[model samples]
Target: MALTRQVISTLQDNGTDIMGPDVMAYHYPDASIISGSLLTVEANHFAVLKSRGAVLGVYDTGQYPIQTPDKPLLGGFVTGFFGGNSPWQYEVLYVNRAKLLVRASGVATSAEMAEMVYQVDYYIHVDSKDDALKLTTHMPFSGHYIKADEVASYAAPVVEQAINQVVQVTPMEKINEHIHEVVELLKEHMSAFLSVFGITLNDAKVLILPKDDRMRELISLRAFGLSELDAVRYYTALKMAERGLVSAPNMAVGAPFSIGGATMGTYPVPDGHASVTLPKG
Candidate 1:
């Protein structure tokens, strides 16, 4: 096909900060490329041409005037000419190169976690150009909704599996201490798991989603480094405040005694003994 019109095309991204707060998307219609076609791609953007679900070529920032003498038409209008150059049909997808934030979760399988749900906040980004293997393996596209599995299918599941493993071995009381360790482990594993998708795990965050009010209280207690006694004291204070009774000084004095006494015999002993013993005598 011979080029006929002044074809003007520019990389169009729905400003990542405002429009695509959560996703990477392109809003441009597919176009026919001629030798004189105007193309302007900016930094932090990857312009890609794909035919039949296969990526043909990847272009970087700057202007590109399509050279079509040797490039044959994939399939499109016949009459198209640009600076005496023929046209070729291809779909263009503008990929956002910036790192993205995503959230993923999985149901815990361990019997100990029967009442809690595990969640992970993760960061993912495209692999560096220097990695020859990732250049070929990583998924070409990311999904729009972190809530949806579309773009996060592989990455999310891999992260969820990693988190579940960590949570299984970790005591609920000390889970926060090992969160960084779990994130580091995920980084190493996802390098291989997500290689086929050409993405990398940049960062990860782990959290326990509580199942009930009690679980919530427990989590809050742990977060604030509060003993159960202290938590009860604070809770009682809140309730008392709600009822509009007792001044702060009086509540403070009454709180510790109430919580301490109420919790005295409630503490559990070791499985083997009700009290400390001096040993066989």
Candidate 2:
């Protein structure tokens, strides 16, 4: 009678990285193989097979029969000579083609202000599968994890350097006002830095807020969608109001009001009539 046997279940596959961000080095567990057992390796992935301590072959993107007859002459000879019915042990490992996400966000300091404290947020991912495998080989890992931060660490120093270079030379006046310009400058260096590890930055953003509450209020005055000159005019109006040079809201109609800096003089009164008008603040 014909009978069927199984190695690994088809249900074992899921998109989750077998080696997560915290776990780096791992190989698939050994499994028993029979003549017609299933061996399926998905597309855009690598399945490295090994016997004993030596790699037998790297397979990808195909279904295959794992039969004794399919084995090389030397391998078959060794198996036959080893004696009775010892289970054939094989190591099959996988590497992925999917991109991995990396994010870095923090306040970077500049020599200009002990630290010109500004915030930055960046999103990035590994650009190449080949490079990621090489990274896995080079990094230290005891079992299954390497830190997510360790994978993206190549970009952090670049970010700091970019911030330092751009912020140090920038005039203190424009540093907080034109942060987008600083981010653009940083991108030039970051692009090259990320390329080394086959990584790419995506939809990254930068924001600079005033550390002082007073300065923040000064900035919020532009909420009216005003042009720069209009903002200046609005600001001047606020200052005038604060100084009491502007009139009170309940002032009588047609009453004359003089601004604090204005030169006021009494006009010679006409004999027939007296006239008065409200003054603009």
Candidate 3:
């Protein structure tokens, strides 16, 4: 087999913002790279060559001859340019290694089955050659450019899954108190899950709160020296008393209570026994 070097054409990504901040990847419309053509990859970008769902080669930030004389067969994709202008039909995808922002917001079920609303703003990027390949292979986009929205769309479910994984084991009352821990756990889970798609879950800021007023009230009660059971009991009793189901004046708990236009007072407790049990929230 005679290896011939032919400069049929030149292939290189040219643009002011070749790999912009929000861009994830760029698919060159031309799916053919002639042998011996110069392939220029910008900094913080990777040029991946794939043919028929197969990745032929991955070039980093550098200039290289696609099919050099040294290696006639470019990863076995090119046998020879016998016709002298033969082009290897391979998809050219430029993956940005620069950090990109992906924001995800969703509702997760907490340990007590409470709906927890979460909003996460995180940065991610294809860190390595393997990750770049993973990004191109796992998350394929049809258009010429892959934008942040596309990355966000792919990451939203993963973020939701991570939130559920962490929130499901965490009680609503402790969500805000242990928020830092929650953020760490979310980052850990998200990083692991998104890595499968070649996306690195970089630094993130996660804000989680109760989805409704009832859950908010419950969490607030827990913040004020009240246990989960106590918070629920107090919250439920307060609601019941507001609705006139429980007697306001006859209430016998130490906590202060006040309803609209009602006299504010602490429930009196009898000696040698706990106060009346309030219905669960």
User: What is the TM-score of each predicted model, taking all chains together?
Assistant: 0.62, 0.49, 0.61
Error of 1 at 106 (Å): 4.5
* Candidate 2 off by > 4 Å: 1-96, 110-129, 171-173, 176-181, 200-203, 210-281
For model 2, the run of ten residues with the poorest summed lDDT: 247-256
Provide the lDDT at 99 for model 2.
44
lDDT per residue (tens digit) for residues 97-184 in model 3: 8888888788988889988889989998888888889888788685778888887787787677766776888877676677787678
Error of 3 at 174 (Å): 2.5
Per-model lDDT = 0.54, 0.52, 0.72
Instruction: State each candidate's clash count.
Output: 13, 9, 0
Ranking by TM-score: 1, 3, 2
- Name the lDDT value of residue 195 in candidate 3: 90
Ranking of models by lDDT: 3, 1, 2
Q: Cα RMSD to native, each candidate? A: 9.4, 11.9, 9.8
TM-score of 2: 0.49
Span of ten consecutive residues with least summed lDDT in model 1: 257-266
Model 1 TM-score, all chains together = 0.62
Q: What local lDDT score does residue 118 receive in model 3, on the 0 to 100 scale? A: 90
For model 3, name the residue pairs that clash: none
